[model samples]
Target: MNPSQPSAPVRILVIDDTPSIHDDFRKILISRGNDASLDAAEAALFADTRSAPVADSFVLDSALQGQEGLALLERAHQAGEPYSLAFVDMRMPPGWDGIETIRRLWQVDPALQVVICTAYTDYSWSETIRQLGSSDNLIILKKPFDNIEVLQLAHALTRKWQLARKLAARMWDLASEVERRTDELRTAEARFTSAFAASPIASTIQYNYNHCFLSVNPAFLELTGQSMGDVIGHMPGELELWPEGKAWLDGVSRGDRLRKHPAKLRTRDGRLRDVLVSTEPIAIDNDACSLWLIDDITDRLELEQQLVQSQKMESVGHLAAGIAHDFNNLLTAINIYTEEALHECQPGTRLHDDLQEVQAAGRRAAALTRQLLIFSRKQFSELAPLQLAEVLDRILPMLRRLIGEDIELVSEWDSGLPMILGDENNLEHVVLNLVVNARDAMPNGGEIRLALRQTVVLASQTARHPEARPGQFLVLAVADNGCGIPLEIQQQVFEPLFTTKGSGKGTGLGLSTVRTIVSQHKGWVELTSSPGAGALFEIFLPAAPVGTVLEATGTAGAGQPASDRHRGTERILIAEDDDVVRNMLAVLFPRYGYQAVLAQDGPDALAAWEKGGGAFDLLLTDMVMPKGMSGIDLARELQSRQPDLKVILSTGYSAELLQQGTTPPIPGASVLLKPYRPDSLLAAIRNTLDAAAAAS
Candidate 1:
């Protein structure tokens, strides 16, 4: 096929009734030296004023019949050395004629050159032409042909065959190369299309001149809350996708590269989304285009804000814990000494009454600090399975009176409701806060309704409320027919310190505390309201698992009267960092018939236990203390030594939170909240000792 190399000899096939014809062709085209006359004739005919005709240029094969010639052509082609020219006699008998033979030859090798060598007028030129269908490969030579003419025809037609073969090979190679390149292009196009459509980054193609969207992938549609029908062939301005950052697009239009340009786009749902838009210049169908990669950062930004808010709340909790610790200690001292002063005075006297007032004020201050701790999630809560109906029954009378006689309070709940695991007191606060807010919404007075029922959240519902999951829940709905909340400010209603009420009229902590308590209980709150319409707040709490036994909410003898309580003479180790709290516990324990030893911190308490040879029956220690140890650590170490040391771990911080994953909790260790009364403290010590005694 390559022309640079020597070509194979042109194969010639002679089909005739006489064998002499084959010899003649050989002498002229193939036989060398013996065909001097033929060579000279060919030279003279072709103007070979050059040299004798090139020798052995043709390979001749003999066939006596048209069928034989056709068979020879087929054999040569199959052998990869096909005959280039076939000379056929038209009047061959007992076999296919020249016309039929030539036609069959062409079917096997259409590129073969054929010449009809006929003496008789078997078929006219018109008839021959009509039968063979005009072809440049066919030629007619008369029977009595001159040697020179024969040589000339042989030389010219054989050269023509060589040129034709070369051209055919070239064309074949060219077509093959074209097909390969086309396949490669098709594969590349498919890969690009697949990758673009499947990319997680929302991508679109826009016509640069028109600024209209040419194509958008699924992620692009999802990010914009639009469909293909909505976006395709539409300009971004027409879709209002870019509410802001048109300047970024303008710069891109001016050939500036847009890389991660921060922008805001309003989705079809009318919510603004934060996004990073990047662009690439490309050409499609010779039309200038731009590729827009949009990274929707709406959820990402919300999560970032939530993380910042969480960190802020954690810092606030730490600060509140520190404040509550010191303040509760001070309150404890004031309340205890005031009670002692009251006991020393007559009930009718001014001094006794004033001490009572002072004690009441101290208690109120303690309550406020407790609220601060609770809002910061540092307050100790006693979690237990509680009947919501029972808790509401006990608190509704107080709530009714708090809302004033002008406002009507209505309550209803489903019977046989499942219990929820939460702190009863905290759940009470949640209800109280919602009811109070409902009351305040209507200055002119309105109806406040409370409804409770079981609810099951489905997976589909979780899409609307991210905090919800498929599970059983108890919903407490609080509805108020009052001036409902405006939609614009609804999201901020639960944020700390956000309020619509005038200064001094509200502290803005009610809903915030409600949110905190609900979250701590592993629940969520949903609000339905519109300005000038009624508002409804629903609290969803997880239901306790079936067959869960309810645990006692209070310790034994928790609310026993002081005069009727049994006194203990057991030795107590009191570990508190606050000097006043430490001294007050030391002085008060002995009056309850309990001997007390004082320690400033956990390490001091540990050292005192070793000094006393582990004789103490109880360890009352602050949960958070200085000197490289905490109350939990002290209890773990002392219980290891004595194994019977009863512990009452106390803290102004959340004792439950502090004890989590710190160590396996000291077995049978009780927790005591700070700002304690003398009676409560004595009762805790007595009950703890009694429990240990009973266990022993």
Candidate 2:
């Protein structure tokens, strides 16, 4: 016996009074190595005291005994002790025969192996075998049983008991392994649930075709404004608030996986928000489900819109700056010639008064040019304390004339309003543009009100207006009780060249110019309007520190004096490549008392200046001349030769040159923009000479 195996061999006890039966059983047990010690009827009564080691034996001849062998066998089976095998004689005469006794023993211990030894091989024993359910462990030995046959039966029963024990042990081991794996799966599920619920982004799980909600994280619940009980197990589209849910579900159903797709949804609060949704399908237990990840993109969309608007404004500003540069040159010529003609005429003469009007109109035209420059962000701004209320008061009469008589004009100004740091003219343009727009909104006549007041905008308030900054602001609001803007067109109202008015009736640049000017002043514009309700345009400009308003000092018009103009005797070099433009200047320059010298390009201009024998009074050169030699280079060469030579650099686009200062290769030089009238050319020449003489 192995020490590691179960302790003790199975014990068996048998009782019989017949000596011959005992001898036969002993012979069988000795062959099988199972020591069968027979106990006589008297010894069996004191079986506990007889320590000769109880042995398994066949019980026989029960009818001849005072203490029946059947009774002894019954006592052994009822002992509740471990037993391997038993053999009983069928001829035993008692309350139960051998077959019946074996059956009762089986009922007491199904694990106990039993067999019957009988003298007669008859049908009665066969019938009893059938009654015992025909167990394989039960066997019968004939009377006068062979020793080998008895030994074989005992060995077979012992092997059967060993096999049963082994099977039970394997079953318990397999059950434990199954229990451990199930526990591990449960723990993994708990971790997954915790991670999903803790994420900030909205997450959801849905079945493939039906789109039934399997699970949703806390963020999804918060975003949809629904409880877990309300959402779980329901169809996603049944929420009613998510208009695009069906479209997303359909996309998911068509494929096993998908990356992020842009989607717009109406939230539970009825507000439209943009989201990026991604989905992937997973097969679980022969069924498919999808996981959806949602990222909110409302803020990103707004930022894109602002970027588009900024780019549009930049393009429009470039256009405006180009126009203003050319227009200013024309004004300069008109101003100079008109002043000259006025000085040469007698006072009150028709020609003199006509020249006076021309000069006045030129000054107004110059003012318009400055406005365009401001809109294009090309002009230099001198910030000073300015009362917004007072500025609005002065602008009301002009606004009234602009809106015309059909529209009733109204003004409301809060007394002692805070001042703002900005150019007064630019502010006036913003106000005028708003009023004009309002007038157009109501062609049939309506009330237009200009309101001015002091206001403080906090960080919270600035969120609504994308361009607003947190600070004290001078709020200038222009409102009209008229037909309002359509929602579809409201977003594009401030875009350059976008207008609802009929073609030629209004230039779409007005509101765009307003926005540019306001932005340049570090301010923001707020627009509120809807169809059928009036529009309100509010501008918030940063309040300036309290100080005295700086009075701008300058002549009524800044132009050269007529008497000290350059004469034809003074040589003037004109460096312009365009034939028409150069020829026009060539023809116009001599009329202004200057001997004109022409140059087809920058090198030609340099040659002409050197060919003049270094006697030219001024060098008027176009900034961008052909053949790689710019006017600035020519001017520098001329200045080196004749240090006192006056130079005026001109260009169609002077923004880059202007930022480098009003000089070519050196500071403090003069510059004139192109497309100039004759007078502007003369005035520029005269101003250059005056500035040169002043510098000397």
Candidate 3:
């Protein structure tokens, strides 16, 4: 088919019985000119403008018989140059005839162009056609062969054979290429399948029409604890792996693609897991599908919940702190007045008994407000390094009566336990509130256990208590066989005002105050509980240095009327902010048998002192004042004027009154918390004046 190269020589094979006939056929075909133009008058009449040029010369070989001719054709075919055309004698053999030889040769090379050289009497054309199936490669020739006719047959048939060979070669190349591409595609698919099977992320491919998994990774099976057989043919909803799984199928069918759907799922074994599922639209077999990626996020969500709750509790604590301060000031006035009335009453009288009841109620109110101040971390702590065991000894008597006969209160202490730096009253409140909370949990009554021991916390162990660091600590544990906190809401129980008790049944500040006070002492709380198994609360406080001595709450002694303890002629200057509280203080000391001067705030008291020419023996001042100067500044000025001036400072909770370190603002000044008894006020005043007198 290529037109540029010189054409291959037309090789011919001639078969006959005589050697003369073989030589005669070769001379006519092979010994011809290279330019063999088949163009005659008819060719000229029907030719296109560009006609094919003359073919190259013919090359011929002869065989004396049919067998010899077949042998010669086989040799040429194996040598890569088979004859394109053959001339056959009609009566060639004593063995095989030309008709049979032609049949055999056509079988060997089906495309071979042939000329049947025969006389009319030798065989009919119809018979020749019958011997070989009719084909374009076959041709007829007369036995008295013309040289021109033989040459033309050789040229045209050989040219047709060359075109056929080129076409076959091109077909072979195309088949090989197609087969190679198919193998490559198969290899790549195999690799992708292996990788999908081995993946760690939970991945799945599902059908678009049915929402069934087309393929699932091993991790997807592992996550749901389902086998491949359980997953493949079924929808995700069918297996109950997703929340309201059947409902989601409706959404997906509506062409809604869920990018990231987060929800809780229960596994096959019934473990709840928080998970995030993301989906991408994919194409599978002419329909759009989904590729899903799932992640387990249970622990992460719990930690985030803890962080949010902590921030909420902290915000509420700040608000409660301010309210507690103002409340204490009001309670202080009520308590002192009640105490003053009690001191004036005679024993064993109905009026005296009523006043005693009022005093007790006042003391209880004061105690409750102090706990509020402690929860806010605003109250000044009366902290000293003390033995928890010793502190428990004094509080146990009161706890036994408070717990009641319905519930048994048991105490266990480890002897020679380590010391902890803590506020005695505040620590006692921690135990009181925890025990009271425990008592409420058991309406039917249950045993409460109180324990004190020394323990060490390592860096790894400190994770259990987020507010604490690695250190030695004294642990105060309280356990009760009461209705326990639920697992889901365990972290919320310590939030202020968050309670499970019915209306008016509980204040809900009990555990919140316990946690707040313990945290203020650089300790942490740990809890362990089950729904019906009761609860255990352990308070861990940083241990004090070795050899630190224990401090105690002062012991009381039986005495005469508290009002008769102190009598002074000296003028006492009082500085207070609230009008009712100021008036109460003004009338109070005079009842105690001492002269009193009254002023509303710091500036008023200072002006009164200057106008009186410093005639006061002692300055009685409130720590937090509305305007002018604070009690600390007032005391500083008064002391400068009279170096031996005695002083007493009163406060509930005030940031302004607290100094650097845990010490009181004014050095050498006596301090009284709000709502103090007439006896306590009288004692502090008497002690300050006496100490001044003794020092001078």
| Count of clashes, each model | 1, 4, 1
Per-model TM-score versus the true fold:
0.79, 0.66, 0.63
* Model 2 residue 661 lDDT score: 55
Q: For residues 351-430, write the lDDT of model 3, one tens digit per residue.
A: 99998888788788888888777666667566688777988999888888888889999899868888888888889899
Collision count of model 2? 4
TM-score for candidate 3, residues paired by index: 0.63
Task: Give all candidates' CA lDDT scores.
Answer: 0.83, 0.70, 0.78
Query: What does candidate 2's lDDT look like per residue over 537-653, in tens digits?
Result: 998888887675756775523464543444345778888776656666665666666788899887888788778787888887777666988778888888889888887877654
For candidate 1, the per-residue lDDT at 138 reads 88
Instruction: Give me the displacement of residue 42 in model 3, in angstroms.
Output: 23
lDDT of 1 by residue, 1-696 (tens): 432222666677888888887787776665556766765666667675454326476777899987777788878777677776778888888888889988888888887788898888889989999998988998899887766676677777877887787777787788889989999999998998998899999999998888889999899998889989989999989899888767788877665678888899899998898999899998899998888899988898989988987887788767876787789889888887788678779998989889989999998888778877887777756678888998999998899989999999999997899998989888888898889889889999989999999989998798756577789999999999999999988878887667988888776767878888888888889999998897999999999999977775555554766745858789988889888888887777777688888899888888898899899999998877887898889999998899877899887766676667556567778887878877767777887898788877
Preferred candidate (TM-score higher): 2 or 3: 2
How big is the RMSD of model 1?
Answer: 5.2
Two-way TM-score contest, 1 vs 3, winner:
1
What's the C-alpha lDDT at position 462 in model 3?
65
Worst 10 residues of 2 by lDDT: 1-10
